[model samples]
Target: MSSRHSRRSHGHSSGRNSRRTTQNTAQLIESLNTHRVNTLTELCRIERVAATASDEDQLAFQGPMTSAWTYYVTSNNLLSELRGLTRNYPFSSDALDDAKWRVSNDPESNRSWNYAWLVLIKMRDDQMVEAYAASEAAKPEMWGGRVPEAEEARQLAECFAWEWNEALEQMLRHWDTPPTTTGY
Candidate 1:
């Protein structure tokens, strides 16, 4: 299976897209310009916020970074890495191999991608056993009540949280600068 998701080129069909461009993005860009901070400073601030946001915050930092890494890191290919490792909670050996292959050929892949891939390649043989075992660790039994279905879902969330958390940490640790522009 292909490890990468396809994206439409930004602002293709200019007239048609302009009619669709909402004020939100424009407003956000204007607001970002309103601040006097350098690009790196603002990016660092965003990384800090994304890393510690609550679940309800829609930032995913409390658990897995998942797609959130795209916001903090510049590489388009790193998304492929995360998508592979976290695919089905990140356990299939074949998928892991594909992820490593996908990232290894890209010279511009983010440093965090290399770090995360290194971390996962070591688990290729055992991640499956380890993940479900983690899922089992959170299952609680009760005397008179059935375990809630939410508990089951939480276990799945917990199953991949550690690996993704490490991924997020690597992103935060390796983030350096913005592209095509001076960091300041």
Candidate 2:
């Protein structure tokens, strides 16, 4: 329906125009698919051995959407921090919900750990190899003490990737035009 970069400035420049029209939408979609597949594989591998303590390893897994939500939350927080927020933004539903809970239970803890909680618990724990690698030992437990299985993680990653890409595409499409202004 809408195309992103329609025209260039000044002159025609045949070579430049050719490359501009060579839309990479298909390539981008393929890349997204590959990312999802790779993410799912990594998730499956890590979930096998997340818990350090005995008997803590057998917790039931979460469904896909929740898992993917965790991934999005973690990724978003990382991106936000890289961009430098004066105060951390709530990047995930889980983090936001935790913050809400803290507002009632312990509001003071809401700032830092909420973001970290989603990252370690939801994102890192999904990968089994990443769990026992010593580095993750320092990671906090947001689930109280639960680990999602590979299947759950995969479904979550795939679903989240699909939904997110779709939403992003939609947003990009809407960016083509500015909103009309009406005044009295």
Candidate 3:
């Protein structure tokens, strides 16, 4: 019985394929780029807003600027670094153009991604936990009257929101140019 038990394999051969798929930095960035562009394009078409709205908005001063940084700072930082390395101090027109295309389509993808990262990093932050709790509490339907689903959702949202807010903060903090109050 002992010998038979020892012969029993812990995992099947197919289990080797059960490993989680991990994207390389470049691939990850590319995926994000695709998502951002698609999201922005759909959002613009759906909202009947111009694709250039993000461009027109000041990078430092505008609400969208804040919002953009608020969500996808890591993606922005990594891409910016890559661009700098490949194109020198001033980014090439082609790189800027590509970014513009993506930003135009999925303006908030950055935000969503950044928020998701933040949630993962600091799950125990009081503010985040509270926020998630609140959201979960709001989903009263999930509890069948006894459970506080909304509170649970709120907790989850809180975790994500912190990350997004941090990413935005990072972007604004590192911005070289002083935010222009005047129209750009």
Candidate 4:
């Protein structure tokens, strides 16, 4: 048996180091959700299993990983931007794959969403939340005690209180649009 499998059975983290998210986390979560909402038109159907699985889980990790990796790399314009003070590096393909594996294997995944649109948005949001939680739980050596309130530091918190109220308002507006298809 691998050490990783053994480790998985036991819960990790002592929970002593976690820190609450600041306002900047709220802002980035907003930007991500806004970007998701603005671009949420369906691509052509996958045609293999619409009912069995979302085209989202069907979409391979590489495509989105490439986009996300590039996004941070370009936006921050530095290799050091790959990680926050207390988190995993964005450039690690293995870590990214492990994350995808964990989520895909989650038994409760996709239980609440019917459409691909909603499923994709919800999954990405869930990942962001998890990353924040994990980052917050670790007291990194480099921090020397407390992470600063800088933009980079704020991105990794124990938990982000997402402004779902505003997001719900945006989502409600999206739903308010007239239906495009006539069939039930």
Ranked by TM-score, top first: 1, 4, 3, 2
If both were scored by TM-score, which would come out higher, candidate 2 or candidate 3? 3
Residues 82-144, candidate 3: write the lDDT tens digits: 333433222223333343444446544344323322322233232333443344345555357
Clashing pairs in 1: none
Off by over 4 Å in 1: 1-76, 84-148, 176-184
lDDT of 4 by residue, 1-184 (tens): 6788657544343232122222323333344333331232221111112222334432442233224323432343222322332144233333333444554576654442223223223334555445533454343643667655555455543233132223323332433322112210
Instruction: Evaluate residue 92 in candidate 3 and report its C-alpha lDDT on the 0 to 100 scale.
Output: 28
- What lDDT is obtained when candidate 3 is compared to the true structure? 0.36
lDDT tens digits, residue span 7-29, model 2: 43324566665455333323322
Backbone atom clashes (below 3 Å) for every candidate: 0, 6, 27, 0
Over 50-108, each residue of candidate 1 has an lDDT whose tens digit, in order, gives 43433444222322332223332234334554545456554334434454565556454
Specify the highest-lDDT model's number. Answer: 1
Residue 29, model 2: lDDT of 28
C-alpha lDDT score of every prediction, in listed order: 0.41, 0.33, 0.36, 0.34
List runs of model 3 lying over 4 Å from the truth: 1-102, 105-148, 178-184
Per-residue error (Å), model 1, residue 122: 28
Structural similarity to truth (TM-score) of each candidate = 0.24, 0.21, 0.23, 0.23
lDDT of model 3 at position 158: 60
Model 2 earns a TM-score of 0.21
